[model samples]
Target chain A: MGEFELIRRYFLPLAGQGKSRSLILGPGDDCAIQRIPAGRDLVFSVDTLVEGVHFPKYYRPDYLGWRALAAAASDLAAMGADPECFTLALTLPAADEQWLAGFAEGLRAASDAFGLALAGGDTTSGPLTLTLQVHGTVDEGTAIRRTGARPGDLVAVSGTLGDAGAALEYLAEPAPTPDMAAMLDRYHRPRPRLELGRSVRGFASAAIDVSDGLLADLGHILQASGVGASLDSARLPVSPSLARLKGDASVAHALRSGDDYELCLTFPEDRWGAMPESVKRQLSVIGVIQAEAGLYLDGTDCSAGGTPSGFDHFRGKG
Target chain B: MGEFELIRRYFLPLAGQGKSRSLILGPGDDCAIQRIPAGRDLVFSVDTLVEGVHFPKYYRPDYLGWRALAAAASDLAAMGADPECFTLALTLPAADEQWLAGFAEGLRAASDAFGLALAGGDTTSGPLTLTLQVHGTVDEGTAIRRTGARPGDLVAVSGTLGDAGAALEYLAEPAPTPDMAAMLDRYHRPRPRLELGRSVRGFASAAIDVSDGLLADLGHILQASGVGASLDSARLPVSPSLARLKGDASVAHALRSGDDYELCLTFPEDRWGAMPESVKRQLSVIGVIQAEAGLYLDGTDCSAGGTPSGFDHFRGKG
Candidate 1:
């Protein structure tokens, strides 16, 4: 079969099932069709992950597929949109059936988990790359943005941070404990906090997905909101596995290392006590938004006359 | 500034403008928030063009940018959806300011031409590739599909075909001719027949975008519709430029050569004369659908006994 036939056989099935009423048409047409709900806004984001750049070249195809979809979907969650559909633009050097099977299985798992259906996309032969454009919807004027943080908002995050970075460290090195392996799995399969994001619709003043380390991604929020933040280093969320590896430096690693894919958000302190127990268990109050314009660690400015650094696509040692 | 900064400066301005009633929250957020029109279906498609794979490695960056958007937008047009918004996922080996400037210019031109607003996307370090995901809208139960063709329907196509293939030949060995340059331009900047598609909404029984050559792309319509077709080679729309390039073999090029991005559709013979004159100017009756279940060339069955070929991503030679 040709590439088109292969796509029709493998990918089209993924598009047709569990689709929302908004999806008027699925795959098999020139394009898939859907309707945006009235009184809601569509949230869209695209992310590309290339082999050896975004993930290790030796990574399994299944995890690669899961991670790629999660990374893109995380952005939608950050915007407090209900995951609707996604289109995957996948490129590979050659069509290896085993690899394709694994990839499709992983993608299907992610789709089912996230309540999203594959809409339509192109499959081509090239270096291994997966680009996913995810579509979502949120009620009008209710979607969270990066530029809404106020000076007195409480800085918070869902789930542990620095685990993905720690996982990467373990992946790059030799054998590690089972705990470390679990941390690595967290890195590979980040569960986007879709439900929590939706639940905190009116609570969060600002929200961002942690792809680049907290300092850098949150810096975007600070920049857009015209405010700064003071992240208490002692309160930073570092997994026990990471703490075991780096001892006291774990806080620094958690602060600077990225790819956690957790939601970093700010809410008024008044709502903190009313937060759900589940959310409270999952999240930690790490800091507070400040009137000044720059990230800080325990009141001292981290960007004090120095360039802010995290992940740089052109220069990062990924 | 690096690639990320360059993108932030140049491309960010293109987002969050125009009739943004559907946009709840726009650029500068973690993700773009759009409202899917409540009762209408959303149509989606994605296409990726890699340097040296889809276009000539040395092709103009601006044209590359335009063609990439055109290729994806054409899919939406074929689905009879109103052009809306698009997200671009661009990967480059390095940041070249001149290349980026030209590319951004081309993107802006296409966005203006198509009335599609730019959405959020990702930029990364990798082999030069551009993946575009275009989203459009169509009313419920009104969007055309590929599986709607019936037996005895009249097969038609919009605009001339094979010019892009002829253009490829001219680019390979510069047999410089004004007609050849025009053909090359057609390959580089295909105008998607969105208006014609929307106009022929109730008329077309089945439709597809002609990216993988006429016969192969149309084969999709036949398979999905459970019908066959007999395409008259003499009736195949060939430009004056292509007629000069291939002489007697022009028919072969029109049948097998890809990258045309035209529309191949089927309509009931009874509705033929009622088609709009503007659409008639762009469309031509090429063949008739058959009771049998395979594509044909004139009267002979072409599906079973012919060598299947179009654009093969891994094997094609520029």
Candidate 2:
């Protein structure tokens, strides 16, 4: 099928039939139109996931679609912006009907779950790559940022970390334990912490979604806010599957592995008591922001060493 | 260099040093933030140009950069929305410093000319692909659409057409006359008529940009407006360079060539007198809208014909 035929059959229907308040115009025009509420600012983010880099080419098409949107949505979560709508610019090797159907289903699932409209997008042919741009809205000057973490603020993380990296390990292993299935779920279908992010808007001094490992992404907050952090290795949140692993392996996974999609944030210690109870229960205090200028692990300095780097896609052998 | 370093060095510098009144926050965060003026709505469009599909793999990085942004900006022009910020998601096989430098220079030029901030973007490793999402703003409910054309309204177009296609033909010839250079420039860097588009806000009833040939794109307006059109073949504006082409080649080029990046619109016949002289001089009243629903080229019916299709990347013998 041609581009329009595939989009008409697969994507037009996926744009969602339900009416939306913020969407003034949907697909079918040169541009899609949306109205932001008065006094609100819009958060815009663009992320692309490429096969053989971001994920394996053989990954499930449905999960891939979900993951692409969820990954983009996580940026909005970090900014504490409510889900609005998103555009998908998809390039594929061919228009496989089965694959398109699976992708559409997962896209729909994420759209419905997040209450975001499909908005508009483009479809073309190339090696499989998905570029998603999400538009979200937050009250003026109320959105959380990565530049507000001050010294003495408490550092915390929502949900468990290192599970997605474990899922990658499971994919390579000939036989993975039944318990690893949960880690796989965490990897394939990460729930963007939208509600929790929104709840923490005024309280969270600084926030960032952990895509590039805990320390690396949190390091962004520290760098932006001009502060350091002392992470208590024992307090770092990890799933039961990861906890079962050996000491260093689990610690490395928690601190150095990426693709967790969990939110690593900092806020005033006093505000913890004011956060909604449900949100409070979902978070774990892992560290404290410090005036010193580097990351410390278990009271030891480990900031300037190792491949302390996350996956740098472009550095891969081309 | 890795993706982030490349972004930090090249893309970050091109984000522009101008202080934008609407862009409240710039890159470095998960999402860039912009405030839309009250009583206005946001217009969004995304375009993906994959190497070997949209353009040759060896095309100049500078032209490719300009073309990518201009093509995306054209969509916003069709909506008669004012220029705003944009996000780019680029995938590349490897980072060639020379190519990156050229691309960044062209990007900076376009970003300056359009007054668009490089809000945020992502870079990754893959076969070279560039996806750009442009956001523009129009007064709420005043933005022109493709569904408002009516019978008897004059069919019009802004700037010239067919030079881009002529440029393609020139590219294949290996060596061409100096005249073809202008055509190639049109193909590589056709201006998005944002000023004309904004001027037509209250005047044009229906509008679209000619990316998929003049007739094909105007046909889109007809389809949406549930109307037909009649073109005075002789009146279709051909670029001065294209007008020099011999016989039917020039006519076909004017009508069937795509990537013109010019506006195709319909407006009231009487209201033509009220248009600013500058805008009127720039627009060509090539045809008239009709109630019967199909495109007639100078009284000849060529709707159901041969490879009379535009560039659809997905349908390449698949």
Candidate 3:
């Protein structure tokens, strides 16, 4: 099929699945038009997933589609923004009808889940890669920023971490236990914490998605806010599946491995008490913001020496 | 350098150069925040350029940067929107400092020229590819769409065309005559007709950017508007440098070439008389929209047989 035919057959249906109220024009035009509701700020982010680097060459198209959109949408979740619209600029080695169908199905599922309308994009011929740019909206001055953390703020994380990183071990395994299956699902279909992000908008002083591992991502908040943090190693949230792995190694994964997609937020200590019980139940207070200038783990400075920096595409493992 | 360091050193500077008023936060955040002006609609488009596909394998990085952005931005211009911000998702096999510096320089120059702010994006490891998603603003209900053309509308195009196509033959010729150099420049740096597009906003019934050849793009407008068009072959505008090429083939290029980055518009016949001289000087009225349901070139229906359908990534020669 030609490019237009491919889009019409597979991707065009995805555009109709979850039409955002903001979206005026969807596809088949020079540009997509969207109206930003009054008093809302637009939040934008782009992420690229490359074959063999971000995912295996033969990764399932459906899972790859879900993972790519979920990962990009996590940035908007970090900002406490309402999901609005997204664009996918996909470059593939060839146009495979079956693969396109699977990918589009997965994308449609995510678009519906995230409430992001498919606005516009491009499809090209090249080495397999997917670049997703997501746009969302947040009420004015309510966007949670990395620079908002202050001393005495409690640092909390939503959901457990390390499951996706732990799942990497069983990816090619044909059969797995229930725990392993859950971890694999976590890796393949990580959900963005959109509702939690929206709920914590005015309450959370700072927020970030834990994409580059806990230590690296939280370090960003600290560095940007000009504050520091001290984490109780024992309090770090870990999934039951990940806890069954080699204990220290699984903890290490939680701290150093990326793609968790959970929100790490900091807010005044008093706000924790004020949060509704339903909201508080999903969070674990793992650390506290401090006046000090470095990350501390169990009273030891881990900011420089022996630091496990997050995945850096240029300098670290792909 | 790591991906963050590379972005900070090169891309960060580009963000500082053209800070759009709507931009609240740019790079260094998980997502950039922008305030959309009240009562305006956001216009979006994305384009991807890949190595060995969109351009030569060892094309100049600086020129690639400029061309990629200009190509994407042209869609916004076609919508008659004011350029606001863009996110670039760039993947490269390696982090070469010199190449990055040159690319950033070119991107910065275009950012200033087009009044676009660098927002947030991702850098990854892969075969070199650039995907730019641009966002612009247009007055509510005023965006020019492909469905708006009426039967009696005058079909117009901005600037002379085919210089870029004619220049392709001499791409590898290092030393060239002044005319060849000019054509080469046109290929490398085709300007988006933003001013002309904006000036014709309320008057122009429909508009499209001529990126995939004039006929192919105009066909989009015709198909969407449920209208036909008749072109005067002799009235098609050709650049002086392109006209100097072999006559018949040059005219073919003018009709079938892509990458012109010029605006093709349709407006009522009487609206053409009201256009200011400044805007009129940049346009050529080459055709008229007709009630008949097919494309006609000098009264000859050329919509189907022997038609040049322009570039398609999957079925065409990319």
Candidate 4:
């Protein structure tokens, strides 16, 4: 089949049944048309996952599909934007019906889970790569920006950290144990904190989704906001599974390992106190914003830290 | 530098100055935020260019940048939407300062020419790849759609056709002829007909950007609208340069060559008369919509005849 037909059959029908009114015209057009509310601001971000670099070739298509959407939507979560639509630019070496089926299923599952529509996309012949562009809408002036952090604000993170990193490690291990199934799930299917992000909009002064390690992502907020964060290593939320697995090294993993897909945010102490109990439970205060613009670990400064071996394409790693 | 820093130093500064009022916030945030005019609907499309698949490895970074932006913007033109903003998810094997500079220059040129801002995007390590997501806005109910084509409407195209294809052929030759410089330019820097698209909004019943050859692209409109087209091979606009080249084969190439980046649209005969003379002069009326849902060429049926081969990723070629 041709590339366009493959999209119509495998991807277009994957659009969720209950689409937001915001998706004016979902798929089947040159461009996906969407209508944001009059006063709302449209927020968008694009992420690309390349084979061998971003993930190994052994990954299941379904998991890759789910990961692609979740990763892209995490940006929306950071901005407190509701997912409206997304376009996929998929480049594959070859088309396998089985792989396509698995991918389409996972994509459909993601669309339904995120309450978004599968918009139009382009598919071409090339090395396996997937790029997703996610679009969402935020109420006027309500989006969380990395530059909104202020000194004295308490720094918080949603959910546990380092599980995905652990999962990656487990996968790399010979004869990986079944006990790490939950961690593997975390790596495969990250549930983006969309609802929590929206709920904390009025509360969070600054926010970012943790794709990079906790310290690395937090540093972004600090640098952008021209503030600093004092992180109490002991206060970091380490998943029980991750905590039970390794020793002090696990803490380092939580601090420096990536793929958490959780939101790290800052809020003024007073406003943080007024947040709903459930919201508060989900958000673990791990640090405090400081006047000095650097990342502090324990008492020492770990600013300009965390896996200094860069994962950037244009950097030394590449 | 890290991926994020590279984007900041090299890409972020390329955002056009005096951004559209719609752009509330640009790069640096997890997601770029933009505010659309009250009644305008947002339209977006994503296109990926792989190192070997989209272009030769030896191609210039500047040309790649321009091509990426222009190819994506062409989708906006097809929808008759005005350019707003675009995000680049660029992956590379390694950072080349010189390549980055040239690429940024081309991106800046395209952004300034099209009047759009550089929104947010993500970057990571991988083989050289570029994914561009372009966003535009069209007033509610004003955006043209392929499905809007009607039988009995006159089919027309903006600018000359098949120049890009000739250029691609020229480039593939061992010693490319400098005399075909104009064709090379078409292949290198396609100008998306944004203004012409907007101007034809109310007059044209349907439209599509000519990328995968005129016949294949027009086939999309025909299929979407459940109409047919009777194309006069002689009436099709052929550039003087293309016409002067290899006779019958050149015209055949005009019909079947991809990457033209022209706008093929349909309009009622009555409405065509109302179009500005300059616009009419630019548009070559090459065909009439037929009751039968297939394409005909100079009284000969070319329904599945133009080119049996598909240029898309999934077909036999891949």
Candidate No. with top TM-score: 3
lDDT of 3 by residue, A1-318 (tens): 778777788888778634687888998999998888999888889999999999988999999999999999999999999999899899999998889989998898999899887888889999999999898998888888999999999999999988888788899889888889988999999999999999998889999999978988998899899999999878889888788764655667777767889999998978877888898888999989999888887787778732454222213221
Q: What is the lDDT of residue B54 in candidate 1?
A: 92
Interface DockQ per candidate: 0.75, 0.87, 0.88, 0.74
Which lDDT tens digits does candidate 2 get at residues A132-248? 998889999999999999999999999888888878868766666776877788888988998889999999999999998887898889889999899898898878877775344
Q: Which prediction has more favorable lDDT, 1 or 2?
A: 2
Clashes of 2: 0
Best-to-worst order by DockQ is 3, 2, 1, 4
Candidate with better TM-score, 2 vs 4: 2
Question: Superposing all C-alpha atoms, what RMSD in Å does each candidate have to the true structure?
Answer: 3.6, 4.0, 3.4, 4.1
Candidate 2, residue A278: lDDT: 88
Candidate No. with top DockQ: 3
TM-score, chain A only, candidate 4, equals 0.93
Residue pairs in clash, model 2: none
Worst 10 residues of 2 chain A by lDDT: A309-318
> In model 4, which regions exceed 4 Å deviation?
A172-179, A304-318, B172-179, B305-318
**Shift in Å, residue A223, candidate 1:** 0.6
Which 10-residue span in candidate 1 chain A carries the lowest summed lDDT? A309-318
Q: What share of the true interface contacts does candidate 3 keep?
A: 0.97
- Whole-model Cα lDDT per candidate? 0.80, 0.85, 0.87, 0.83
Candidate numbers, best TM-score first, in rank order = 3, 2, 4, 1
Query: What CAPRI grade goes to candidate 1?
Result: medium
